[model samples]
Structure formats: structure tokens, C-alpha cells
Target: MTHDTGLVITGLAKRYGDAAVFQAVDLNVAPGEFVAIVGESGVGKSSLLNCMAALDTWSEGRITHDGVDLGQLTEAQAAHWRREHLGFVFQAFHVLPHLDVAQNVALPLLLLNRPDPARVAQMLDAVGLQGLGERLPSQLSGGQLQRVAIARALVHKPRLILADEPTGNLDPRTAAQVMDVLVAQARQHGSSMVLVTHSEAAAARADRVLHLTAQGLQEPPQQAVSAPNP
Candidate 1:
């Protein structure tokens, strides 16, 4: 539970055989800071996030969080580490079909054996899903489902949050709201966030915006469209 230092990724590279997806990537995201990485589709943006979460391995370099090297962790150790220190929001809404909103959001807490009904309620309220917790995922719209995912991700007070196109299926207004909720919750809990988005508006909400290419990560040449006022 090292919270003093932030995520440090140095010379990170990922490849398959001789074909390189991305290489020579160097970046640092301070604790509690939010960073957005934007790139063309198929540039391995999602792969980068996966590598950071220890769900995927890298070919070279190191990824350290609070001085803990992710590459050194065994699969079981990585799973345990992720549960305790990471939160992830996926584009597909990954909510279970049979579980109610509250139950879905409560899974993380349950896994950690730290069930807190009040905390679940607080997260639902934070994501504007307060009274709808009893509803199943099938009963919710795309926007509502995404909110449920957001709530679930933030409920455990994780140190690092990785969001991959959370609002890709959302309308502009809903997307804006989702972004607000995500950013607000991350700041409130002092968690570092790394967002991979193709949406310029979403990318603009981050503290810094970087472009990902076959060569590596770098500042974008063109300015991103800032998030519209909600």
C-alpha cells in the first residue's frame, strides 16, 4: 500500500515476434494525477493499459508503482495486487447480467472481504445511480450501465484506475456526466488515473494528454478539444 509515490513507466515496450506494437514508451503519472493517452485505433492503447494492470506482459523496460515492480509479481500475486490496488472501467460495461447494480458494484468489496453497505450506497449516489441499485444490468440503458461500471470501479478506493473508452457508447451529454463523475471520484480519493480514449473531449479532461504511436508516447502535436461544460 505505497501511496506516497506515483506510477513510473520507463522504456516500456511491447511486441509480438518481430512486429512491434509500441516501443520505447516512457511516462510518469504522479499520485492523484490523471493522464489520458490518445492514439489511432489498433495502436495498442488497450494493450498498454492491460500491461500496466499486469493483465498483459511487456517485452522490455519496467513499470513500477510506488516502487513495486509489476513484472516481478507472479500471476497469483498480480491478481491479489490488482484487487487491492487497482480499479478498472472497461468500454463494454462488463456488468453481470444477473446481478443488481448494487450487487455488481459490491463485488470488489466482497472479494476483499470488506463489505460496507454504506460505502456501496455512497458510490451509487456519487455516480447518480442512488435509487436504481436494485435494478439489473439488463434493465439499464447503455449510459446507466456505464455509470454502474464507474461506481463499481471507484467503490474500493483503489490507488490506480485504468479506464478504457468508458464513454464510447454514451451520448455527448451522458459522456460529459460520466467524465465528471470519474474525474471527481478519482480526485476525491487521491487515486492516479490513466485513461485510454479515442474521444478528444474525454481526453481533454485529463491533467495531461499524450499521443501513442508505434515509436512511443509523446505530447500531442495538436490541441485536444476540451470537455464541454456540463
Candidate 2:
């Protein structure tokens, strides 16, 4: 699968009745770019990500990916588009309870009708779940389940990756490890990634970090990287 990878959002806005979630948001994610969005809780960060993935409707704006306007696609077409070009990792580890780790990671390839056992194993190893492919979600800890999610999300090499608070449920060490894997995988595949997170360590790894506010996306004060603890 091939696509002209890039994302462009113009005049993006979301509203309900008299309340506006966010508005006048213009952002561009170039191919291979990893952009992180940071904001306070309930600032519509996840909502914005949903709109970017075409999973939710926006009140006004244009969200174009690889020259295709998402708003122009029908629901069925949008689902197809998502299957073909997008991968998502959410705060909740949405792993299938019935399927084992390997099968869960293989789901995207199955959807694309291109099953490859080798790819599944490779992703398992990539996310540090090598020998546990046969284990069910019930057998894994919270951090391990999240690793499976990361592996699954990047297994298909989707042109665009959307991660919403992917490490929200993990300890700081696990979160750092997951962030390392995520950034590494996206860069390796030249995929653009939009990560919404409250973790400073995770956001620090992004190519660009933008703060979300009621007004729009803005550049926050530059944060100095804290040296690693001995």
C-alpha cells in the first residue's frame, strides 16, 4: 500500500450549541513528522484527534490527507480510508479479549487482506512481546497490554498514526519505554504521527510540540530537557 503521506488542517473548529470545543485551528503535519499536542484535561485534545482520524465530525474546517478531503468521503468510504491509511492507539488498550497478542497485532493486515505471519512476529519483537504472542489480554499487565497496542498500531505502517494519551495508564519508566518504541517505529516507516499526551517526557520526543487552547494551537514556552537521573 502506498500513499502521498502528509496531513493539512485548515480553519478547524468544533462546536455544540453555544459551546465551542476549539476553533480556528490550523496545523500541518509533513510526511515523517511527529507532532505532539499538549493541553489541560478536557481541552478537546482527544476530540481534535478523533476529527483528524475521521472518526468524529467537526463543525467547520478542512482535513485533507494525502490530497483526499476526509469530509468529502462517505461513511463507508471513510471506514475504508481509515483501514487503508490510519492506525490509532488510545488510552484504553482496546485489545480484543478473545484474540491472543499475535492475532490482535495481525488484525490490520487481515483487514487489508495481506496476512503475513512474519510481520506479526516482527512487531511482537519490536514492542517487547516476542515470546508472549500466544498470551491473551487477560494474561498481560497494563503496561504489556499497551505494548501490544503500540505493536498493533505500527504493524501495518499506516501513513498516519494517531495516539491519544497512549501512556496515560503506565508508570513513568514504562511510559518512557513505550514512547521510545513509538517514535522509533514511526520514524522508521516515514509515517506522520500526531500524539496527544499530558506527559512531558513523551511530548519532549516529538519533532514539534503544540499546546492546545480555546483560542487555537499555540507554541508553549520552550522547556529545557532535564538531564537523566544517575
What C-alpha lDDT do the candidate models reach, one value each?
0.92, 0.91
Error of 2 at 22 (Å): 0.7
At residue 59, candidate 2 shows an lDDT of 95
TM-score, candidate 1, is 0.97
lDDT of 1 by residue, 87-173 (tens): 999999999999999999999999999999999999999999989999999899999999999999989999999999999999988
Best by lDDT: 1
Off by over 4 Å in 1: 1-3, 224-230
Query: Root-mean-square deviation of each candidate, in angstroms?
Result: 1.3, 1.9
Evaluated at residue 77, the lDDT of candidate 1 is 89
Question: Which model scores highest in TM-score?
Answer: 1
Write candidate 2's Cα lDDT for 139-182 as tens digits: 99999999999888888888999999999999989998888889
TM per candidate: 0.97, 0.95
